[model samples]
Target: MARTRPRPRPVATGCLMGRLRGNPWAILCVLSLAYFMAQLDISVLTVAVPDITRDLHTSFDRVAWALGSYVLALAVTLITAGRLGDLYGRRRVFRAGVVLFTLSSLVAGLTTTVDQLIAARALQGLGAALLIPQTMALLVEAFPVARRGTALGVRGTVGAAAAVVGPLVSGLLVTVLDWRWVFFVNVPVGTALLLATVLVPDDDRAPGPARLDVVGTLLVSVSLFCFAFAVSQGERYGWRGWFWGLVALSAVAFAVFLRQQRRRQSGDPLVPFELFRDRDYALMNVVSVCVSLAFMGLVLVLSVFFQSVLAFSALKAGLAIVPAALCSMVFGTVAGRLSDRLPAKYLLLAGTGLTVAGMLWTAAGMHEGADWPRFVAPLSVIGVGNAFLFTPLAAVGLRGLRPELAGAASGVLVTTLQIGSMIGTALSGALLGGGAGSGPTAASSRSAMVLFAVVAALAAPACAASSRTPRAGGTGDRAPDEDAGRAAAGRSPCREPRPSGPGRGQGGVPR
Candidate 1:
């Protein structure tokens, strides 16, 4: 009898190359559109707040719920959604999120009352939370590691551009048509994107046997909710009693969550402790949180300053951010490309330095009578610095993660970002005190600038930490080796070991 010939398996390189040649740009477009819609929704409504308030017959403070509620919901559920995507399938969750977001946009557009709009916005946030983590996970699964930096750069650029365009577009719509149009516009665009997403092939990788950690999720959600609420409402409620009480409670909840997570003997933890075992991943989280805090705080302060202090209209204020946004988009791509070739730590450090310098300059020069051009120069510098930080920091955080942990890591990364934004906005708002002041306008500007400078300064240590982090697959990368050795020795890598099964992918896609 003759021996049978064995069938050859397709090479990963050939498979990936074939996919790229066939429909590479399609996925990028879909992902970019999703990201753009999510970011645009967040910033676009800012300029329309006054109009929304007028139409809803609500006060400015009540109108803030239009933004705050969405953010609060997003911050609370972001991690849970990410983990859920990892557990089930990213594509499924992402598609569902897009549909939900589209429906919510319609609800918001048709809303007649303040309560209706707020509920719609909260729904929108929930959809966004589901959408964001899965988007990154899809990108990671679709793109090779060598190209991830570029992909992430494109994502960052689109997001930043959307932020810049949001107000300008919203101002035009509100001025010419109605504030509701801002939400209405998303309907057509989102519908098209949803149809397009359906054509994108799903990566139905096998999932691990790890079950969801319901208690951990609840604890973390409560903790983050309390923390975000405390930060956001601290000024209104008074920092001494209710604010501090919530803060303390949040801390305790966090502690309890950590303890419970550590105590788990089986099932998937809401956040795998092993993910943070990597120094780079841990440091990246810190850096991401700090950078987000600084960026959000600066944007909030500058938006108000540009309109109130510099006497710019809403459209002009939106346009003023254009240069910075453009600079960030340009620099972000450059930095991302450089990240593939150069040491990420140095790039991150340089970016942080530039950001710090820009913040300091802004702080020093922000006088009531300062020229707009002078302010633009510093703000543009800050944008450049942010661009520098965006891709490298992301690459650093996710550099060496295996395919299975991708979703969780991305979830944690985004969660940190949301937390940072909440904290930054809260801190800045608390200091600004509802943007009202009978004191010298310069004094108010100075106080905001100082707050920004302090946040920027915090990035320096994160930069240093990045420098010390070990790269994946490098000799110095001890965490992976340790985990591997533990697995080899029949010990579980997680704090609480469950029955062995497949691991999560590096991009947060199940495998």
Candidate 2:
């Protein structure tokens, strides 16, 4: 009987491993969850800003930096973090990011001072930057070309969902507990994300070790920080001389960074120019930025208007906005499926156009006597538009890119989004006269909505200019710039057959 003690169930264990490795859906689920956490953190603290200022006994200016600091750090680090994933392994970097994010959230929750909170938030941003690119790269790797659009659609929907839900969750937490619990909430979610990493197979890095572009990194980091800080703080500082100086410095640094990147193209550049060789990818970056700018700005304006102008409580304001999120969720599922069958450009055009109309409708409704009920229809319209917008943008924008360029392309795309969001937030805040004792005037709210409408309208042109995405069950899945991408990497022009065996190669394509 002792000898009959069962050996470890090797066959069962093997099957489990086999299923984990073979399943792309499992990978998508894990990546989507992690992405949701990153996105949720970005907006969750908006409702808590005033609470934080009161609790920490900090001036509004200092407390505001907590938000700006996180965004600045994230924007500055994203490109470098993506390249790091290329140099190292994506799954490994993703795990590291999860750990850093969780720990920083703990620190943020415990912090008693504005300085501590800002620092912790900055760390959280850095962690987010590290992992975000990997989600796109890994999704591309796990799914075949035929299903890639659907997968990206799902990821986009998750991001959109998380973003809209953040304020609702924050309002709930702050109402029941303290404001610090907004940060505290991430700890458990991040821990679960860490555990979920087991389902994400390790991504294959480049064949050889490549040195990071130290100078380019410094230059870009400085440029992004200076630009972001200048815009975010300009109104608070009364558009002082130093603000203009920072803007000038940012412009110079960015110009120099571009020049250096051009020179270093033969070597390892911080931003791979090869990514922009695909016309759709380049235009998509523009669309992504415009969309984020319009959306984030509108959210900021509406959130403040609801609480201060309508005199709703934080929780009530969040509830008022829930219809938009719910509508987006419902339509997003439809958009995802459609992306697989339709040309993404058409969807993008329709999405942006609808968003523009919705914003204008919403702006018209923003009057002195407005109630939450007046917003439901317009917000739902915007929600449906948003669902159509991002899924196709991601699916089409990234379609023709070389798998190897996934991280870099993702970084650039997301960096544009971050920069756009920062700009939108800052501009809307200035328009609202956030520092004024009185709340936003009806005129100011309407003006902000108009600004958002204008910005969203810009994406339509870019979408129209994009290359057509290959439809599933129709044309072949040949990337438009496949040969050009190979040549840019100094590979031979002769096409290498895609591997389909159990063995995997760089970027996790099967070999």
Candidate 3:
């Protein structure tokens, strides 16, 4: 007797959740909230550092691990987590992550020692890594190609808002309630996310049995940890020889990992090389790093400038930057919509140019006596620029990728951005005269901003290169892989193909 396949559950029937289930917009809302919660944790703990140190009787340096460990774990595990989503279902992996993150937040809230808090934070980071990649991959699968940009744009807006709002929220929580509430806040959010998981489509996984690249995972994880450790701790540790040694170890391990991937590309590699074959995808990776580094470095410097130099409270400083974040939220969605109609490269160029201008303007205007109000314009310009760049960046980067590879591609893209942010933090700290705790002088802040402007400017050429190939707007254009397959079949991939039938087009959709 032949085995019968089990029927998949119907998601869009029965009760209220069932009615909303499998709806692309509903999934987008759920995914966006998950991303927001994860991104919020990245910066929220900083404002609670003082209270945490006081309550736990720990030194500032030790308390710093609460932030560092979270970031480190997130960065290192992202690649593996992405691949896992490909093997397992994205919704399954995402729900598991939400569960871990929620439980970890509870543990973190109840922790009596700083060490326990650090452990909980690391777990939270791991949880974030698992869910974040799935958010992108699932978005790709849930929405059609035409509507994907709008969805991603909305998600980007939420993530940007979360990052900016975290400080203010932390301050409010710590002030009125306690520092413990910082972690406790995530409990309700996480629970909501888990409950909403049922709304997500259950078919968001690659169809295959694939092996996890254990060796590659270990190698890349070690490399990322070493590199992150060196970058984040170099200034704190006085740039010691051991720090440089770790950097070298990271480099060597990465080289080995690349070799392993090359050998295993025919099998189940953690990162599929085919994703990089498209010029836009490869160039976008560079663009991702540059944009991340520029934005994060400037934020670090300006945050310190607002608080330490200008004597603004953490909440006030967060409020000062609210204009930019608000602009990012508005313009990012617009840019995403525009990307579906226009080439994303032009927006990237305009965005980077504006960011460079805004950084310089803010830098020049930043004086010791200047209040936070003085930065509203320049910061707003930077925010608008960020909205444009980040919103369309993902759309263009993943445009030509195969659906099966979306999870891995999302992982690689996010990892570059994370590493870039870490680097920016290290660079900003060095330029700010050691760390944010030290009162950064006006001159140092200006110099740091200038450095960020220069970094932002570097993205222009990469952006230009990323879009030389025509986009898949109509029957005339095809995805890179399809074009490659056509070329291999001895046909001109660039030549427009005749419509398949009446009211049907090249991609097999009815007009």
Candidate 4:
């Protein structure tokens, strides 16, 4: 006697709408608040470097470590944290991260010694690494395909806004109160977010029976940490034996990680090799890394130039970035909406061109006594370009991932972003220090800006290459796997898979 299959439940639009309508933005708000706290810690602390150095009797290098440690930790653990979320549950990991981060923030604020603060900041980074990927996974799971662009647009806008607002908020607090307030501020916000997260429903998606690649995780962590450390300390150590030794170790670790990944191709790899089979996804990853590097480097140099070279107050320097931030928010939202209607390639190309143009403008216009308007327009233009670039790249990167690997892909993407930022900060800082003696006045800053402009110019070719690929799910046909599932559920059999490679069945569906 054959058993009858379970009946497929009808998808009720009213029920779906009802479930979503009850504070749908709650999750986004929680994630955004956490993100804002992290950004604030990084940016705000930079402005308080002098005060920290004076109070703690620390050198510039030690103070720099306070920021670098957090960045390095975040980059190293990002992919690992994402895998953890996939193995357990994103909601659980996210809540854990929030609790850890809030506690770490409190510890950081109370720390008396520099070493204690550095350790606290590193802990905060660990929390951020766990929190970030889950946010992306949650967003994808919470929103329907039709509304995803809007949701992501809001996410991008909030991140950009935080980048702008963090410095200003930090400046005000540092000037009026003390540097400890920067970390202390996260406590209340984090507490509120933690409470709100309990209301957001969990995604009930089934998890795959994949083992965590512990060896791969260790190798990747060592490689990234060594690389970040070498870059961060390169100027002090120079190209001496110790520096080269670290670089060599990093190279060896990278080689080992690649070999391990290749060995586990048939099994569940830490980072699935199959994910890179799609040329568009591969190129987008490259673009994402490069774009982040350029943006972070430019911002670092510009902030320093405005403060140290131009003698602007911390508050004034923070406010200087506001025009660009506001413009980026507006354009990002508009571009996200347009991406739903237009090809992502066009938006990327246009954004890349604008970015290049803005960088060129900065390189040309920056001078000791440059008018505010000249800098403002270029900054705003760059922000607009970034707005266009970020959302579409995000939309494109995860466009055709399988549901099972969505969390992993999101982790990879966010990891690249943080890694790129770390590299950018290190490289840009090196350029500033290296070029310090080349001239008097703000010449070093100008030279560093030129380096950033060169990087921005390179993005155009990458964007052009990306624009040539066809959009995901453009074949207008469902895959064989989806068809089989539909038939099993008693729905009419869907169309056959697109005539592509073996992995094509899982490649077209947006995770």
Candidate 5:
């Protein structure tokens, strides 16, 4: 008798299914590798900008487009990317992003003109848009509720802190290998991550009929492009009629998109309005944007100051940020662990408070004939702020979200970060008298530093409001694991315990 043949796994071109599955922690490590690649790309590019502008014979205006195009691509595609993961399998979407990112990096490395580089970077952003949200969603899905906070903390510690360390790494890479290596570097890393990702267990797609919000996606994509383009160019172009027109169009598109989202039934909202009902989630998101505004701008300003004002070499300028990065790593690891037990609000408050102080210290020390040593102490202070704010803040914002909505939520959160970073970079440029490179005056640095401090200081009140917001489903106290379990299944904790409680604070803020 002929024996039955063993069934072969289905193979789709350019698609993968995970085999030889590992535990959640191991999978997180795999995801972190990819996340690290994304973070490093940005950091290295930050240091590479001057070199790129020189080699390509481009003006500051064109180089700005290179950065702006990447951000616009990220903002436009983020929601769609997240929704695709919900509709198809997230693992498939993630791997595709890796391939896209790697190819773009290779092309970016080979580009001879500024426009070609801009196009390649935009593609790189698209790849990032696809994979970044999935990594966050996957982390939320994999960890148990009791360990969820800790898990997120670890992920944040790596991903967030890497951006801080990226300058040093990028500096070295650019110094030794040239600015092109910044993009070339991702090729090998992305390949490694793509292979590692294939070992994780297959993630389940959202059950039941789910459709991508095509109309909503289009509206938001257009809206983001208009707003981001206007914002990036507003200061440079003097906010002309065309500029304000784009801003107006962005507003109109946003309103129309919200209207469209309101018509959708429970299972298919692109951005679930209900999530905003929890004040903690909403306020924490605000805090997310504000905190990032402060953090990202300082990097650009200080990096410029060190390299230009102080006349440090790329490697030396990059090395200067090491104190802050080291501080963030040490503090971030501890904060990640603390987020498990402490009220995230307290940590947020401390972080913001420290940030304000740190910013003040750094700003006051700025002068044309500055002593570089003075910066180290203040920067180290800001590093401590990173420890307190970065991971704990993320844990709080995502605290009560349902697992199924994780992709959507993560997309929004990361978008806020990118937006904030853009705002900060733009604002820094404006403060520096609308230019960069070897001309950052002490007065301008002071002004920008003060502005960032005030912006970051807003987090204190936001965190206070977040502390008062109720958890999702308007529920009272529950076990951590129980909380995760109920949320994982899309069953609100409010239902079992009844919605009639003091859980809803003023503004209907839910934690």
Candidate 6:
């Protein structure tokens, strides 16, 4: 007897999802919510930190592992997962990630000990790593060059919403219910997202032939794990010899990774180093890292200041920042529309300048006690600034990347943001000494603001540097006559091709 071939479930699922094919906006809705879940998980857990420590009878130092494990695991595996998506299929891997993340959330919520929670968190991170980049890659493939900015802006807004929701929801849950509810909350959201995902057609793999470089993947994964672990744990462990050693290993392993990638003359390399040759792309990455560094530190300080200085309850503190979140949502759409008309350089400059102002304003509030009403203005300003910065930056990163490289580029871009977040959090914690209520907390917040401002200020020069690129790549400045494959006029890979004749296989219709 002939062996039976397994019929894929998504074939049926895809038919169910086929209604969403021409509706790119609806597809984006699914992607945005999924991305929001991944982003929200990190901040939500932070709110429950104290409760987790007390309930599990774990030391404050040990419970830190819950956060660290997740961050490290997410960072280390992103690149490999991205390439694998290119090699196999994004739809399958992304669905797998959703299942893993939801199950892990269940495990995390049920755990009685810190170790169990930490292990479950690590699995959650791995799931997150697999899905996040695929979201961006699918975004790039799904949207046309003309409207990509608007979609990216929507994604930016979703991220901002995650920040706003994470604290508020977590605070309420930890206060009114058990700390485990933070994990439990994901169950419903993840289920809804998974169902929505099944209703959308799984994106086809990248157009060109691709192959996975196993050695390259291993090297980079090891390097990233070492680097991410070192940064996440450095402050807690006191920068001891082991800490420095891990950092050193990260550097060495990364060097080996580069060598391995360079040696792959035929196969698909984990990272196409050639992408950096585009000046606009390189500068965008630089600005992304710096902006993320400042944003992370600024957010950490404000959250601490509101509760510690103003004596507001956790829920109140979270609600106080609502103005910023609202502003970001309203203006982010405006900025996305503007991106299609304005040069990206100007928006980047405006964003950084606004961010600096917001940071200074928040720092000012920390002086002589918290200025309750005063902080709202700056928070709103930061929201608008973030809207301007992120979407255009995403457009810049996607510029000139062929469809085949979308996943890899998305991975690299998000990885830069992750590293910056880790560094900024650690640096801000160091600056604040005891985080929120120390004798120098107010003064430290000011100093940290200045440090972040200086970093934000640096993006101006990089923005200037970016303008030197040929038409600035796709910064709403590319010439019409440039290579069609790399510009706005290029065909999107996600669109189904037209059938050439009657009864053709394209749409599977008989004449």
Top candidate when judged by lDDT against the true structure:
3
Q: Per-residue CA lDDT of candidate 6, range 1-511, in tens?
A: 1122332333222353453443456668888888889888877887888899999998988788998888888888888887766666676677878888899999999999999999999999999988888887777655666677788878877776676668887988998999999999888988888887754455554444556778888888889988888887887666789988999999999998888888874556888886676677778789878988888887777777677656677888888877777887888888887876777678778887887888777676677565568788988888888777776787766766566566777788888888888898888777777534444356777788888878878888887766522344342333445444433534323233222122333221122
> What's the TM for model 3?
0.90
- lDDT (CA) for every model shown? 0.75, 0.81, 0.84, 0.73, 0.75, 0.75
Which residue ranges in model 4 land beyond 4 Å of their true spot? Answer: 1-24, 204-208, 433-440, 467-511
Model 1 worst lDDT window (10 residues) = 1-10
TM-score per prediction, in order, is 0.85, 0.89, 0.90, 0.86, 0.85, 0.87
- Cα distance off (Å), candidate 5, residue 466: 2.1
**Per-residue lDDT of 1-511 in model 2, one digit per residue for the tens?**
0011221221223544443542567778889989999999999988888889998998878987898778888898998888777666778888998999899999999998899999999999999999898898778766766567777888888888788889999989998999989988889989988987876655544436467889999999999989988987787787899999999999999999999999999888889897787788889899988999999998888888888788888888888888778878788878877887887888898889888998999999998879999999999999899989988777687777666667777888899988888888878878896675755988899999998899999999899988665432211244448657867876433323222224554323434
Model 6 clash pairs are 17-199
Q: After superposition, how far is residue 57 of candidate 5 from its true place, in Å?
A: 4.0
Candidate 4 yields a Cα-based lDDT of: 0.73
Cα-based lDDT at residue 37, candidate 4: 67
| Residues forming the 10-long window of minimal summed lDDT in candidate 5 | 493-502
CA lDDT, candidate 4, residue 12: 35
RMSD of each candidate relative to the true structure:
8.0, 7.5, 5.9, 6.7, 8.7, 5.9
Show pairs that collide, candidate 3: none
**CA displacement after TM-score superposition, residue 103 of candidate 2 (Å):** 0.8
lDDT of 3 at 23: 63
Model 1, runs deviating above 4 Å:
1-24, 205-208, 433-440, 467-470, 473-511
Superposed model 5: Cα runs more than 4 Å off: 1-20, 206-208, 435-439, 468-511
Winner of 4 and 6 under lDDT? 6
lDDT of 5 by residue, 92-203 (tens): 7899999999999999999999999999989998998999888877766555444556667777767767877788887788778788888888889888888888555455
Model 2, C-alpha of 411: deviation from truth (Å): 0.5
